[model samples]
Target chain A: MNCQDLQRLVHAYLDYELDLMTSLDLEAHLNECSACRARHAEMRALRDLEARQLRFHAAPAPLKARIARNMRAACGNDDARRWRAWRAATAVSVLALAALLAWVVLPRTLPGPHQVVAQSQEKMVYHIANSEDVATALRNVANLLEISPDARIVVVANNQGVDFLLRGARDRDGTPYEPAVSRLKVRGVDFRVCNNTLARRRIDSSQVIPEAKLVPSGIAEISRLQTREGYAYMKL
Target chain B: MMPHVDAAYNLAWWLVRNRADAEDAVQEAFLRAYKFFGSFRGDDGRAWLLAIVRNACYALRGQAPGAGVNEEFDEQVHLPGMVAEGSNGPFCRNPEDIAIQHADRELVNRAIEELPVVFREVLVMREIEELSYKEIARIVDVPLGTVMSRLARGRRLLHEAIVARMKKESPK
Candidate 1:
């Protein structure tokens, strides 16, 4: 092939998209051509520069935690349901019955919510998965407090949701959301985050915003709030 | 959630162009992928996961300025004035030249952010993610020729933008 033909095919060759015959033809042309060879060299160098220089942000801690925790919880539930179905299809052995009875009689996995102060009439648990979720939860909290200032509302942020409680966290436009968090805090709304998610994400305890408290697990906390605290649950 | 989280994150980051939105997009995509995991039939799990991410990114309300749910790739509108590959001048940042001067990723990132949405994605798939052209074509749902043209044009614009930024940062 000629220099002009080789020029168009250089990218294809570099990308390994060229067919065998075309690659051989380009190699033959490269042996005799100076300018085409120089272009080829430059393309390789640029590709190298790109590989070394480009930066990528990892799947940050909270999101990673959210996925892992949600997946595990979802899978655990699905597996239990599936196992029960399988067992029902077959004969229910005495050993299976004993195991089922043991689970039913055991104490709850999460700690019971304490009646720390005067109990409010309305109790609600807000689940926040993203910063925007936090926004929705906060708006709901403010609206709820407007109607019932003495209402007991708890916002539980876990997984990627902990980002809302991160210090100096910014919205998509780089606007800080800290003042809004402070406003919610002053109104007696409680904010709790999942420590398991935080630990797995490798975020230090200090990274958490001042207004939020850490819980052992998000899923467990949500369960505790719903079952033990008599709180209505809303996930944003 | 899959072995492809890194690849998935990279694709979303390139498309959404920010940490918070990209994280949201990836989280939503993984949930969708997990929900539809049984329906997956391809061996290219990374590409499949990325297709979900691309969809999730578009579904977000006000993702980036140009990203939309139904992204139509029209080559005729996008293929004008591609720089000649053999030409080497100010528009092209030669590796030898780039090495001599300091190069910051933020400048390169800004140049990428400014491209037409489709061109930016194609370039990102090919150059950053190192996906094959066929894989990119599958993910973007365009023909092979469209992929080639966009990639070439995207690379052309990216190189020009990088060189332009370098010149502005440290004038010769």
Candidate 2:
């Protein structure tokens, strides 16, 4: 390689972008030519200087959090839409099952209408799947308690819904959910987190707040509540 | 995609020269990536994502009036006093002549920041991020030769800028 060729290929050589034969030729030229060697050294120095001095700006914590939240929101919406469509497709059968349960089970289990008005308690199970659902469930539970002070509310959280109950989980406003969860826990609401989700997501149960009880499976818990405990299910 | 966030942010930061703007660019780029993910054929996810990031940075620059007006690199204007390509004379003075070993972080950073965006992106990708030329070419949407040329020019421009700044700051 000549001086002109060395100058043209030195940067690529320094970058290790050249092929083996070309790289060997460049190195040979560098060994023979002092001027090209000096220039190559300068180029190498600049490259090394840049590697030493250029700051690599990592994504800030907030930015990562924001991107994660956005991704979850997008994916969550897609999942919710798919779930809604599936639910819509099965609405008829679900409605028929609801009617069958009400018809065959209510009269045998409940008191007379006059006594039912005064003595019956409202039992509801809420399914939460994301942060927004957590917020909605919180609002709905609060409203239910206001109307029926003796109401039983169980919030079963799985998927990203479990995040709000995790330690250090925060709302969009940066307020911790611990306070809200603790407040509702004292009000007789049961917050159950899905252990299955924790295992799948590789999260330790210790990471969950004390206010939530870890259930074996959120779906199974919801099923048990609906079938054996006679709780009305609501997905928020 | 999540793994490449840092790489994307680094490229975006150097391209836009601001933390907030870089964050914005990365966010937008990820959103674009997610939206068009169906189109992605599952090659190198980092390179694909970075290409989106580079485009997002340029789009951002285009939106803000006068933000990147001088983005088009003019060889004659930007390479003033730069050695002619393939000439026998030295491409730059010896490293010691410019006191490069003594060039502090701020000096090196400012000199790199002064480079045009086209060159700055390639330099940062190649030098700081240590990306391969083909990967950079894929990200920058340029040919391999263009990536090499830009990297060479970017390094020379950075060296010249640092030298000039050191001379200006010198006591004599």
Candidate 3:
């Protein structure tokens, strides 16, 4: 192979993509050509630099948990339903009696929702996309807090949802969202606004109410809450 | 399939160039994969997941308002001798200077980040992920020859960009 031909095949040769015969030919050319050898070395150096320096972003723990949760939710429900259907279709009289007995006994033995909540800290995330969403989120949070005063709640706002969090912003009836936000804040409810939307809409940080915290992205916050923090998600 | 999430996330992160969008792309890709999993007959699960992640990244880019345009590769613009023979050639410098340049993580990262998405993707697949050229071709949905050329061009561009940055950063 000639020098020009070697240049074309050099990366392939470096990558081991060249066949043995072709690689031997290229190696032979490299021995004779100092310029091609230097070029080859340069490519090798660049590859090493990349391997050593370029960051490989691993999936975050929260993301993995989120995917697992989603997969379980998607597949588990379908599989359970399918199994139940198959059992119902194939069951003889004795199996039907056994299944009926199990169904009757299972509910009494399993912990109820209230008991489950009492055993662990109740955590919830509310995704708010607009003004109305904020209203509904506030109501739900208030009710949940009344039920479980120590429940952890976070309300995430993006897009037009952030409008209510801004100072001087009001609801349709000219009622400022600040008082309700403050009430929730005192009750330990966290509020977050998406900084991306804030920047896109040209809203300054100072414009946001004191009760609201600025997050890098609202959707990311919601995902993190659900996956990493074990918070139940509610989109209003 | 679950073990490939990190690989999928890495590819999606490089393609989309942002954490938020990358996460969204990965989530969407996994969801799609789950939905159409019966169609997946391939033995290499990582390659399959990465292809879906790449598609998801592009789909997210399409939805983004005024996303940056990927530059076209022009062979004539990047003639071979231009960088190799220059004062800033990789081997032209002393060993210590070369070492220092490579150690600068931000410089290397910025150089790769500045390349157009097409070249960047191929470079990441080969250099970072260590995928074979044929595997990269399948994941990128391009001809094998196209993968080789893109990898070559991407490395050259990356090398030149790094050298230029080192030259600019060095004290006179």
Q: Given candidate 2, what's the lDDT at residue B150?
A: 75
lDDT of 1 by residue, A48-150 (tens): 5666676655567677677767665666765544432332221112112322332344345622221211123556677888765765566557655643467
Model 3 chain B scores worst on lDDT over the 10 consecutive residues at B64-73
Question: Which one wins on TM-score?
Answer: 2
Candidate 2: global Cα-lDDT?
A: 0.73
Predicted candidate 1 versus true structure: per-residue lDDT over B1-172, tens digit per residue: 2234556777788887888888888889877876776666554556777888988887775554234423354423322233455565222333335441246767767778887777788877776566778988898887787677667656655765776778778876
Backbone clash total for model 1 is 4
Which rank order by lDDT, best down to worst? 2, 3, 1
The prediction achieving the highest DockQ against the true structure is: 2
- Each candidate's interface RMSD, rounded to one decimal? 13.9, 14.7, 12.9
In model 1, residue pairs whose N, Cα or C atoms come closer than 3 Å (at least 3 residues apart or on different chains), thus clashing, are: A62-A159, A62-A160, A63-A160, A66-A159
Residue A149 Cα positional deviation in candidate 2, in Å, after optimal superposition: 51
Model 1 TM:
0.52
Which run of 10 residues does model 2 chain A get worst, by summed lDDT?
Answer: A87-96
A1-236: candidate 3 lDDT, tens digit per residue? 87657767888987768988999998898898776777777777777788679987888889989997886687577554443333232222222332343344344553332233323356667788987677656766775564346778888999988999999988753668898899999999999999999999999999999999999999999878755665656666
Model 2 stretches astray by more than 4 angstroms:
A79-236, B63-78, B81-96
Candidate 1 Cα errors over 4 Å, as ranges = A1-7, A77-236, B61-102
When sorted by DockQ, best at the front, the candidate numbers are 2, 3, 1
| Model 2 TM-score (B-chain only) | 0.83
Q: Write the per-residue lDDT of candidate 2 for residues A68-184, one digit (tens) a residue.
A: 778667768655444323322222222223334433555566432222222336667888988777765786676456435577889999999999999999975376999888877
Q: How is the predicted docking of candidate 1 categorized under the CAPRI scheme?
A: incorrect
